[model samples]
Target chain A: MSPTCKLTYFDAMGIGEPIRFLLCYGKIQFEDIRFDFEKWPSMKPSTPYGKVPLLEIDGKKMHQSAAICRYLGKKLGLAGANDWESAQIDMAVDTITDLRLKVTEYYWEPEETTKQKKKETLLNETLPFYMEKLDALVKENGGYLVAGKLSWGDFFFAGVSDYMDCVVQFDITKDHPNLAALKKKIRELPAIKEWISKRPKTTL
Target chain B: MSPTCKLTYFDAMGIGEPIRFLLCYGKIQFEDIRFDFEKWPSMKPSTPYGKVPLLEIDGKKMHQSAAICRYLGKKLGLAGANDWESAQIDMAVDTITDLRLKVTEYYWEPEETTKQKKKETLLNETLPFYMEKLDALVKENGGYLVAGKLSWGDFFFAGVSDYMDCVVQFDITKDHPNLAALKKKIRELPAIKEWISKRPKTTL
Candidate 1:
């Protein structure tokens, strides 16, 4: 029997986008469950940690976007074959999520002063640090983040970098040529490109 | 040849403790490397993402405590058995880390007014939400966070809850009785109990 997979999240790109992208690109059949903000309070109670992006598979619920992504990645053959490579994929994806959360802080800060400080920190401190590391990893693994193929990490980085460019008003790859190239390469993938173009456009 | 691992951080029970606990409890032999605050600037360059709790495995380096913990957890059979249970464990551990990071904000705010507001939010919003959810998960999984076994999520929660009790100046499990019991149960594990007793006591 095909497993029942339903993704619960608001109609935004926040955490749900990666899952959507992965499933769509892989042609995996699952429900793209979105919720109205008005319904979240009641819906929140059912979630594992009172957060969305919960994946219900075969009557079991799981939370955490990274965990959900990894599960889907493994199921879809996007994660690597062995434990070490899988850990490396997890490391890369988790790093992207960390950087994305930092960018989110720019939106969460109350005033111009705090937001400005955060923006500056992002530009000067956080972005370069992550970009350089990503560049090194891409270079080390021969342009892919994992095991010489397009693993979930590549898709995650592509999604995150795209979101960062759209939200943070900074060109992430301007300085890091290799990371820029990596994003471009992932974007050029036939299945990924098709999925990106045809995918539902939502504000997360 | 056995791979050698070295973990470097400040000699405190702050961010580095969870990784240390995982390493020790898993019986994985690794160097418990520490550094003085005075020497951090010089030390930061050697780290990826310019952060500590950096793990050097057989001459290769990896950063991010959660990533390291998850890697070691999988390596030592502490994560979970299959894809789904592993995802649940990851979700729980990451949620606790999220809550812990938010709690850290109480200390970082420079102004007393902001700190007070953050403290209030911590008390009213964050703590109860996480406590209730963790309590539910513990109860649902039959007194364990994941896989009906003592996974790293249990230890991660124990470390975070212990930190909350000691550092955040709040008894997290006061309302959540199941969470309180799970914490007690985790604390009484022979390996964890022995490690907790021998673990160097420090204030963050």
Candidate 2:
């Protein structure tokens, strides 16, 4: 067995939750390290980019949640075997990440005018566009995002859909039948369902 | 031989440059596709996220510059072989990406108050901090980002440092000796140098 992993983040789910879910579902033992706001100042300097979701494998620390998740996926044999599948998986995850970043900008905007504009753009343009593409990809790939198998990208997409539903007040899956079916299928996976049920609740 | 690859983006050496460099350096045959502002609106809707730097492999389209770069890296044997090395490469690339996004925000802020605040935070807190860590990592990993060989992460970092030097009035590599050395090393590579010389020059 490999050395145990340690993940550091704030108490909230935010960027770190998907990684936590992957680890738990893979049955990998890891330390779920958390920090309070008061402690972040001291902790900030120690991280690569002074951000959370740093992963410690054995004794060496690695930062970036996407990188961490990819590493865990490879380690757990969740990433596909060949180059094409790996590329496809990376593509799908990157798409989800792109959507998530837009959502992040909505939260970070301080002015009501800019925030409203962003929200309008998201609601009117971004949301439906991504939903349509995701739905199409799901259908094209035989109900999976890549290689027609359960890969990390599927989980990442499911997580993003769940987040959008929670934060954007949009019933993402409901609007896109394929996406809705994909989410339901992912949730019904025995290991994933068990992991979701047993995992600690997080406030993002 | 594989079918010809075509990449489309703005004429500038922005996000599209990395994929261009990777493909050219790897001796992969690809069409260097570019466009101006007049073409962007009509072209935008065709993109997956209404963004550029899309790659067409064997006539199949792919979006997201990072994902395209990673896919090309794998095709060109630029990404590391094993899980650990691949993770290190990905982590480094992702860290650079994080900093780039923050830097982009500086340009996008419309308010002077917010812009000033972002500039101060970035220069005083974020910039030097990331440089120091990157310098240490480059040194620790034997002058390459992963497993002592030139990986896609090295190119990604070089592209970032080059962009900072071009756009921002600050000397990004001067403060960090290892980072400066790494950049120089990447620049000195024959294939990279040749590709750089031949690359289309444009203002982003």
Candidate 3:
């Protein structure tokens, strides 16, 4: 049976975007609900973990965006070919997550001086190190993040790297040919391309 | 052939303990390598992600503690009964990870003043809310974090929550009856009990 699905998040390509990309890639339809930050306080009380990117399946809500992606990846056959492959996929996704948290740590800083310091650390040291390593991984895996096949890791990296690129406000992939190609490849997919064409745009 | 495994992290339980607990739960043998902070900078360059909790399998190294846990969960037949249950397991583990990170953010702060303030926020707001919710989740699932069966999520939580309890310098389970019971149930298991009996004790 086709389960009713709804995804709720702030109107931005934060963690929510990857889940959206995964659903679309699988040709699954869901109610994509987004609201402004002003609406979050009231909405927070209803969320499972007081966080966005919640997935409601047939009215039963579940939290954690990465977990959701993994579950749906399995159901959609985007997980991996086998358990070992799944681990590889998981490893790739999580490495990206660590990189994401570095930026989020900066975002959550309330002090301007501390925030600037974090931004410098992210740009000067963290970003180059992680991006370069990941680019090499993609190349090693024959242009995908793992197993020489398209998995949730690819969708995850493709989704979050877009946000990372926007925040860094530069062509993050300019120096890495394979990662640039990965972005273009994922972006050009029929489902993702269509979703991106119509999805709400904001300066995330 | 069974692959040889080596798990490396600091001498503290920290993230490595959960992975250790999972392996021990399965009665899987591994080389546990622990180091001190003084030795980390030199070791960092060789690590896959420049982080600890590195798992080396048959000479190939990989990173990400949670991902490593998931892989071992499957291999040990402690993941879940099926895809849906595995999703629930993933959800539980990731949710606990979210809670753990809130505590780690404070742990990473270099400023004593900032650390104390963060500790206050954790004590007054974060710990109570999350522990209460997790307690409820455990009760709802009938004394386990996910399925009624023992899974890696249980081991992960049992291991990390111990560190959380120590860092907060109190028994966080003091008020959460279900979580307390869950912890007791896991800790008393034959393998976990045996591992705890012999593992090195650290302040963290």
Candidate 4:
């Protein structure tokens, strides 16, 4: 039998959404446990690294969003065909994550002056640089993120795109047609569509 | 036959050493290409995402340090015995990466006052919290990072520990005996020892 799975995270979609996407893509039934800032202090100590987006499979708690995504991707046949292919997928996922983090660092900056500077760099420099490269990848790979076919990297990027947009106050898909199409394709998948429609709504 | 391999990174260890360790552990001979800061401007445009630690195997250049390390680890039979074990190792590696980044943020801070504040928290809170948790993990897993056996995560931690310590000006092993022993075990491995003795020397 499939092990009982439960994923815990904040109500808003951040890193948690990618993991949720993977589970939904695989059609795996899991308890979507969400909480808020008020409950975080009490819950932090129980976590392995005081971070959420934790996955409990058969009562074994697992942390780190990337690791959990790869595990599920591998189990569900969404990683790749072999080690080399999986490596390509992993590289793409990491790249997407790198770009995501660049946006987030600025988004969460406390001081207004520093935050504005970061935002300027992110918009004028970082975002365009990454978006162009990623657009080329999607176009070259026939509309998928890596390995020329659907993989968890695609799910991951699609899942986090909304949060990224909200954080940056910009539509990442703005001139990146290939990436926009890829996101649309992934979102339209039956399982993902169902999950998106029912998942808790949040601004970010 | 093993595919011809080449690793290109800065003259420093930083993120490149773990991949080097994996290749050496498996006795896979490859070209180790090191470059200086002056050469980076010209080289940056050639990289996938304007980063170093690029690994080229059979003319296929792959970027992303974590992805390259995982690929090498899997090929070298050091990733894990199975999917679940690989996931466990990935978690440990990611967790270590998180702590490493925390130290780096403060270490690279330009303002003295902010840097000092970050250092205070790091030394008083961040370092101890992560070190204690990681130490317990190594002890429980019997001198390895995960799955109760040697894995790529062990190599990654050992390989990066010196850089991390140098940046933060602290001996992480001082209070974490189990982690210390684990590092010793990895460094003393015949292959890793040979690599360490012969590898390029750098402060970080």
For candidate 4, report its TM-score: 0.96
Instruction: Sort by DockQ, best first.
Output: 4, 3, 2, 1
lDDT tens digits, residue span A1-204, model 4: 644999999888889999999898887889889998679999999998888889997567788999999998988889999888899899998899889888889988998998999999999999999999999999999999886888988988988888898897778988999999999999899999999899888878
lDDT of 2 by residue, B1-204 (tens): 644888888887667777877877787788888999788999988787788888888566887778788877887888897878888888888888888877777756888998999989888877887888888888898888778888988888887666666556667889898888888898888887988888777654
lDDT by residue for model 1 over B68-141, one digit each (tens)?
Answer: 78877877788788887888888888888889888887867898999999999988899788877788888899
Per residue, candidate 1 scores C-alpha lDDT tens digits across A73-150 of 888898888877887898888789888989888867888898999988988888888888889888888889977787
Per-residue lDDT of model 4, residues B1-204, tens digit only = 554899999998888888898888988889899999679999999988998899988567899888888988888788899888899999999898888888888978998998999999988998899999999999889888887888889989987887787887677888899999999999899998989899888878
Model 4: how far residue A71 lies from native, Å: 0.9
Instruction: Choose 2 or 4, whichever is better by DockQ.
Output: 4
DockQ of each: 0.73, 0.76, 0.85, 0.89
With a 3 Å backbone cut-off (N, CA, C), the pairs that clash in candidate 4 are: none
Q: In model 1, where do residues sit more than 4 Å from their true spots?
A: A1-4, A35-46, B1-3, B58-60
Give the runs in model 4 whose Cα sits over 4 Å from its true position: A1-3, B1-3
lDDT of each: 0.79, 0.79, 0.87, 0.88
Candidate with better TM-score, 2 vs 4: 4
Could you tell me how far off, in angstroms, the CA of residue A103 lies in candidate 2 after the best superposition? Answer: 1.1
